[model samples]
Target: MMTANPYSFRKVALGDLDLLMAWQSSPHVQKWWGAQEPYTAADLADPRVARWIVSYDARPFGFMQDYSVHGWENHHFAHLPKGARGIDQFIGDPDMIGVGHGPAFIRTRLQALFDAGAPVIATDPHPDNAQAIAAYKKLGFEPSGPAQETRWGLILPMLLRP
Candidate 1:
């Protein structure tokens, strides 16, 4: 059996912008996530999504965001059942990679979503991101459909049902 997750999550704030930018520039993140402009105050204030900074042992090392699948018009995950949520995340600290933190924290977050009444959780990772695909599989996410190109990029849609 798995032990309890050691990660904690808090909302991303303006002060985290620099850290987020640095992480996005890391080769590991950049390879799979691509470079992203730092989030602005307006972006964080967007009601459609909730962004978070994930920590372990009180040290911040990752970022995550979740949003309503149907919040945006023409969203790739719009076909999911009502009340489904979509999540995107990455481990920022290179030292934290390959230590099982990804799956542990993700499972913790998914449990929270289920406890809050989210019937399904959706994710769309780029088809070439084998590491991410494998982690999601270990967490019980299964391919919901074939790969498709969307505004976000080419993704293999996956979902987990509680």
Candidate 2:
């Protein structure tokens, strides 16, 4: 597991597969979660798909990932060392929505990547998530146009100081 302490970031373990599959199948998360079929245990075990277990306050609250090189969207970050290590996440419990933790989590994650020298950080949400779009802007992400009729909403390439 890879962790940046004060905030714990751990590698996805076999035990996490089921939990991830739960998020993959959630109704609210589904509209924008790529609309792929519900994930099977074997799918979660694939080495090609990277996963990070996002826990907060002693409870699992979210999921983070960088898909396989052969997958969609990741092509935008294929130039990186790992081919796809930008950023993507979903808060598992709907109760956490609009509580302001999202902006903080996103800020921390991007800072962690930046300190590690990541050249860029990116994420795409379904165009309908107005709340998410507003949150990204709060974290300094600006819209960079749409992707395949899907508005990517925001992409934070590199944080530049003004």
The prediction achieving the highest TM-score against the true structure is: 1
The alpha-carbon RMSD values of the candidates against the true structure, listed in the order shown, are 1.8, 5.4
Report the error of model 1 at residue 38, Å. Answer: 1.1
TM-score of 2: 0.69
- Highest lDDT against the true fold, candidate: 1
Q: What is the lDDT of residue 93 in candidate 1?
A: 98
- 107-157, model 1: which lDDT tens digit per residue? 999999999999999999998899999999999999988999998889999
Predicted structure 1: clash tally:
0
lDDT per residue, candidate 2, 2-62, as tens digits? 7554345677777877787787778877766656555556766777665677777657778
Q: Report every candidate's CA lDDT.
A: 0.93, 0.62
Q: Candidate 2 at 33: error in angstroms? A: 0.9
Residue 148 lDDT in model 2?
37
TM-scores, one per candidate:
0.96, 0.69
Error of 2 at 67 (Å): 6.2
lDDT of 2 at 97: 62
Clashing residue pairs found in predicted model 2: none
